[model samples]
Target: MILDDFLIYNTNGLYCKCGDFYLDPQVPVTHAVISHAHADHAVASNNEVYCTEATAAFMQLRYAKNAAKVFNIAAYHQSFVVGGVAVTFISAGHMLGSAQVLMEYQGTKYLYTGDYKIQPDATCEPIEWAKADVLITESTFADPEVLHPDPVVEIKKLNDISLNIMLGAYSLGKSQRLINLITEHAPQKTILVHHRIMPINQVYERMGYKPGKYQIYGRKLMKQQGGFVYIVPPFTFDSYARAKDVKRLFASGWKNLQVNKQDTLFISDHADWNDILEAVKQVQPSQIWTLHGDGRHLKNHFNNDIFVKLLS
Candidate 1:
C-alpha cells in the first residue's frame, strides 16, 4: 500500500488524513498528535493534543495556560481510535515522554518515529520497536559515517580536565542526561545547572528517575572553584564564549555544534546511522519514509531493497 496517500507533509507537519490529525504540527493545529514536548515538535496552541502523560506534563510546564485546550493522554503501547483509525503510542527513547505514533488503517500500519535513540540511558525510557508496513523515521544522523561514540566515554573526559567547565546542552533532554552521565562517570566534578533547566529537571524527578545531584547555577559558584561542571542552555553558554577561567564544551553529536577550544563531547539523544539501520531492521517495513533531515542516505542505502520516500 502507498502510505503517502494517507500520511503527508504540509506546512504544519506530517498530517494523517486517515486519522484526521497532525503529527507534531509545526504550528497551531486543531488535532495535534504530539510525539514529544520539544519546542519544535509540540506547540501550545493546539486545540486537541494526544500524547503520553509525561509529555502532557512537560507541555503544561512549558506552556502553562497557553497549552492545548484538550489533552488525550496515552501510555506506551496503548492503543486508541482517532477518526476511525487505530493509533498507538510507542516509546521512542528520545526523552522523558517521547513516542513513535503508530497509525493503523485498513490493516496497514504506519509508524512515525519522532527523534529517537537506541543507546542505553538511565534517564529516559529505552526505545521500543513495533512492526509496521510503513516506517516514517527521522534522518537527523542517517549518514553511515555519523556513528555516535559511547556517552560514558565522552562524559569521562570531564574528569581529565581540572578547570571549571561551562557545558552547553539542550535544557529538556540533554541537560538531564548529562547530569546522570557526569555523576556516574566523572565523580570528581560537581554539577551545576542553569535556572532555566530546573523545572524540566523537576519534571524528570517527578517521573521517578533521579537525574543525579546538582545545585542551581550561581555566578559565585562558577567563579569560586575550578572543579565545577556548570551546565547551561545554549544561549547562556555562547554568551560566556569570551569569559576566561573555564573551559567551554558543548555536548552534542553534531560536529558543527561542538565548536570550542576543548575537545568535543559527542553525546546525542537522537539515533545515529547504525541505530537507524537497526530500527529499520526491527520494524521490517515494506516502505520507509524519512523526515526532520536529509533522507538521501537512507534512500540511497535502501536503493532497491525497500521503498524509501523523503517527506521533507
Candidate 2:
C-alpha cells in the first residue's frame, strides 16, 4: 500500500499538507483548490480559492452571499507552485471549468480527477490525460457493465416523439450540455430552458463553448410554438404548470431513474466505468484511489494487477 502522507492529508476534502490547501473541500478553509462549479465540489466561504476562470465566475453566481474571498484563476495546463508543491490544472470534461488537479512534491506526482468524463461534450473543455505516480479518481459509474449509452440516442428520443416534451435536468452542467446536444442532433425541435440555466449558458458562450439555439423558459413562447421542448431544473419542473400535451422526462443515468418508465431519459455527464478504465490506462498510476460513489466495481475489476484503494 505505500500511501504518501504528505501529498494527501484527508480531513475535509483531499487536503495537501505540503501545499496547505484543500482540493474541493466541503467545509470552508483558508486555501481551497476547487475542481468545478458543482454544488458539492465547489463550496462557499473560503479565504482564497484557486480554480479555472469559468469556475470562479460560476462560484460568484452560485454562492453570491459567501463567495470566495479571493479568486486565483488558473487556465488549463497552467502550472504553479504552492508551498514547494508543483500544481497544474487539466481539462476534466465534466462541466465548464471542471479540472483534474495535478500536484507534485518531493519527487512524487499525484493527479486528482474531480468528476470527469472522456466522452466528447459540446458545451465544455474536452478531457485530457497524463501519467502520475498516484491517481485519485471518481467512481460515479463504477460498474463495469454500466457503460453509458450515447447521449445522442436520448436526444433522438425527444425527436422521435411527437408530443411536447418537458425535460428535467440540473441547471448547471447537465442543462447546458443537453441543450447543445439537442440542438446539434435534433435541430428541428425548438428548445426552451429555465431561467436558472440562462446565465450559465452565457458563461459557456463567453468561454467560446457556445451551445446551440435555446430560449429562456416562457409560457408565451411555448404557447406560440405549440410543440416546443421545455427544459426545466428538476426541482422547478413541477412548479411550472404542466401543459396537458407535454410529456415529462428526467435525464439521468441512474438505474433508479428507470423505475418510472414514463419519464427517464438516460443521459449523463459523468464518466462511466469504461471511461474510468481508460483514464487509468492513460494515467498509468502506480496506485489508484477512488471516491464519490460505490467504488467496489472498479476496485474489483482492477484487483489483480493494479493497486486500487477506496478512499471512502
Candidate 3:
C-alpha cells in the first residue's frame, strides 16, 4: 500500500519503503528511519537515517565513512516532517534509545514497532502505546507456549547454574538487558563482558543506568575469577574450542525451538505471546501487521482484522 507519495515494501530486514523514503536501508531505501542500531535493522547503504542519538552513534562507530545523513530524534514523542509525511518516535523498551515510528500522511496514521517488549525494564524506558490506523509490530515469540521466565527470576536461575556461566546473546540489546538484570538482582556478582560489547556498555552507563562492575575479557581478567557472570556475543561460541572449559548458555527467542540447548535460550528482547496480546489490547489498533520472527503463528490466534506479514 502507498502512504502519501511513498511506496511500502517489506524488505528482508526491518525496512519499509515509502516512495523514495525508507525507514531502514538494510537493502536500499532512499530515506531510512531506523528503529535501533541492531546490525540487521540498520545498514549503512541507506543515504539518510532518522533515529535516536544513541542509534546514530552506534551506526557511526560500526559503519564509518558511510555517507548517510543521520537525523537524531529524541526517544520522547516528537514529530518531524520527512518527504511531506509527519513521522514521530516513541520508546520501544527493547534497548537504550529503541523507538517505535509513527508516520502520518494524508490523514492516515501508521505505526511501525521495531523489536519491542512491554515488560518494564530498569535499563530502558517502558514501551509506550500510541493510537494508529495501521499498526506494524513484531511477533518474535508469538506462540502461547513460548513464554519467557520473568527477567528477575531467569537471571537468578542463570546465575545459579554457574556463577561463571557465559551468556551468549546479541552484543547490543540482549547483552544490555542481561547486564541490567544481573546488576539489579545479582549486584554482588562480578559481571565480565566481551571487548566488543564494552563500547556500548559505556553508552548505557552514560545514560545513568548502573551496569554493575564489569571487566573486559582477557587472560588477566579470566584468571582473576573462576565464578563470575560473563556476557558475550553469540558468535563467541563459534570458536568454542578456546572456551571449552567455560559453561556457555545461549539466550534468544530462537531457543524456544527444540534445538540444541548449547545453541539457544528462551530469553528474548522482544515481547513473547502474552506480552504481544497485552500490547495489542492496550494499543487497540484498527489493523495489525506483524514483522520479524514467527509472526504468522502469533497472528493465527488473533482476530482476522489483524494482518500478519513476515519480514522478507
Give the TM-score (vs. native) of candidate 3.
0.86
TM-score for each of the candidates: 0.98, 0.94, 0.86
Once model 1 is optimally superposed onto the true structure by TM-score, how far is the C-alpha of residue 27 displaced, in angstroms? 0.6
- Put down candidate 3 lDDT per residue, 182-281, tens digits, no spaces: 7777776677888999988888788776556678876565555456767877677555635645666776666443234543446667888888888778
Choose 1 or 2, whichever is better by lDDT: 1
**Candidate 2 to native Cα RMSD, angstroms:** 2.0
**What are the RMSD figures for all models against the true structure?**
1.0, 2.0, 3.2
Q: Against the unseen true structure, what C-alpha lDDT does each candidate score?
A: 0.91, 0.84, 0.71
Worst 10 residues of 3 by lDDT: 1-10
Which stretches of model 3 miss by more than 4 angstroms? 1-7, 10-19, 72-75, 256-265, 304-312
RMSD of 1: 1.0
Using alpha carbons, what is the TM-score of model 1?
0.98
Query: Global CA lDDT of candidate 1, please?
Result: 0.91
lDDT of 2 by residue, 1-312 (tens): 334564454557777887889989988899899999898999899999999999998999889869888989999999988777889999999998999999887778899999998878988889999899888998888887888998887778777777778888888999888888888888888999888889888888888988889998777776653458888886777565454667777788886644247546888888898888899899999888887888888777878788888776
lDDT-wise, the better of 2 and 3 is 2
